[model samples]
Target: MRKAMIVWGGWPGHDPDLCASMIRGWLKAEGFEVRIETTTAAFADPAIFDLSLIIPIYTMSKIEKAEALNLCAAVSSGVGLAGHHGGMCDAFRDSVDYQFLCGGQWVAHPGNIIDYRVDLTRPDDPIMKGLKSFEHRSEQYYMHVDPANEVLATTTFTGEHAPWIEGVVMPVVWKKRYGTGRVFYSSLGHRAYELDVPEIRTLMTRGMLWAARE
Candidate 1:
C-alpha cells in the first residue's frame, strides 16, 4: 500500500489538529497507510524517505535546519508533498528551503473570511477535471507563488478588499516539481469545516493523489 504522513501542529487558529484528522480519514479512504506526527522532528526521521507522500499541516511554525533539509531532500528525491491554505504555505517562515519546496508562500488574506470565486484555469488537468468554477466564502489568499508552477486554478481580486491588487488574478491551485518530486498546493481551506465544500474536498484529495509518487 502507498504510505503517507501528516505532520501537523502550529497555530491553534487554523485548527491544525482537527484538519489533520480530517485529512487522515480522507487518505485512509483512498487506501493509503497513513501516519500522523505532531512535531517537526518527524521530518528528520530517515524513515520518511520510504513514504510516498508527506502532507504538512503546520502553520507559522519553525523547523530546525536539519529537519527542514531532510524534508526538502526527501521531496527532492521523489516523495510527493501536498497541502492547502496557511497549513502549507504559511509554514516555517524562517526556512527558505522549505518555502522553495512548497513553491509558494501565503502573504495576506485581504478581507479575511469573505466571499470569493474560484475559477478552474486548467479544467482539463487531471487534478481539476470535472470541476467547475464555484462560489466560495473564505479567506481569499494572496500568495507569492513560483512562476514555474503549472497553475490549475485561479481567483481574481476585486479592489474592494485590497485596492492595489484589484483585478489581479492569483493562483488558487498549482502543481510544481522539486527535483523529481511532485508538489501540489491549494489556497483554499481556512478552517477544517471548509472541507465540507465539495469542490475544495475534491480538489484537495485529487491533488494529493496527483502528487503522490507513482
Candidate 2:
C-alpha cells in the first residue's frame, strides 16, 4: 500500500487537529496506509523517506535544524509533500528550507476572513480540471511566492484591508518540484469547515493525489 504521514500541531487557531483528522480520513479512503504524528521530531526519522507523501498541518511552529534538513531531503528524494493554508505555508517561520520546499510562505492575509474570488490560471491541469473560478469567503492570503512555481490559481486584492497591496495578484494554489518530489499548496481553508467548500474540497483532494509519487 502507498504510505502517507500527517504531522499535525501548532497554533490551535488553525484547528490543526481537526484538519489533520479530516485529511487522515481522506487518505484512508484513498487506500493509503496513513501514519499520524504530533511533533516535529517525526520529521527527523529516516523512515520518512520511505513514505509516498507527507502532509503537514503544523502552523507557526519551530522545527529543529536537523529535522528541517531531513524533511527537505525526503521531499527532494521523491517523497511528495502536499498541504494547504497556514498548515504548510505559515509553518516554520524560522526555517527557510521548509518555506523553500513549500514554494511559498504566508506573509499576510490582508483582510482576514473576507469575501474574494479565486481565478483559475491553469484550468487544464489535472488538479484543476473541470474546476471554475469561484467566489470564496475567508482569509485571502498575500504570500511571498517562488517565481518557479507553476501557479494554478490566484486572487486579486482590492486593498480594502491593506491598501498598499491594492490590485496585487497573489497565488492561491500552485504546484512545484522540490528535487524529485512534487509539492502542492493552496492558500484556502482558514477554518476546518472551509475545507467543505466544494471548490476547495476538489482542489485539495486533487492536489494531494497529484503530488503523490506514482
TM-score of each: 0.98, 0.99
lDDT string, candidate 1, 49-150, tens digits: 999999999999999999999999999999999999999999999999999899999999998989999999999998888999999999999999999999
Candidate 2, 15-41: lDDT as tens digits: 999999998998899999999999999
The C-alpha local distance difference test score for the whole of candidate 1 amounts to: 0.94
Residue 144 displacement in candidate 1 (angstroms)? 0.6
Instruction: State candidate 2's TM-score.
Output: 0.99
Alpha-carbon error at 179 in model 1, in Å?
0.5
Q: For model 2, what is the C-alpha lDDT against the true structure?
A: 0.94
- Which portions of model 2 miss their true places by more than 4 Å? none
Q: For candidate 2, which ten residues in a row score worst on lDDT?
A: 106-115
Off by over 4 Å in 1: none
Q: Which clashing pairs does model 2 show?
A: none
Worst 10 residues of 1 by lDDT: 189-198
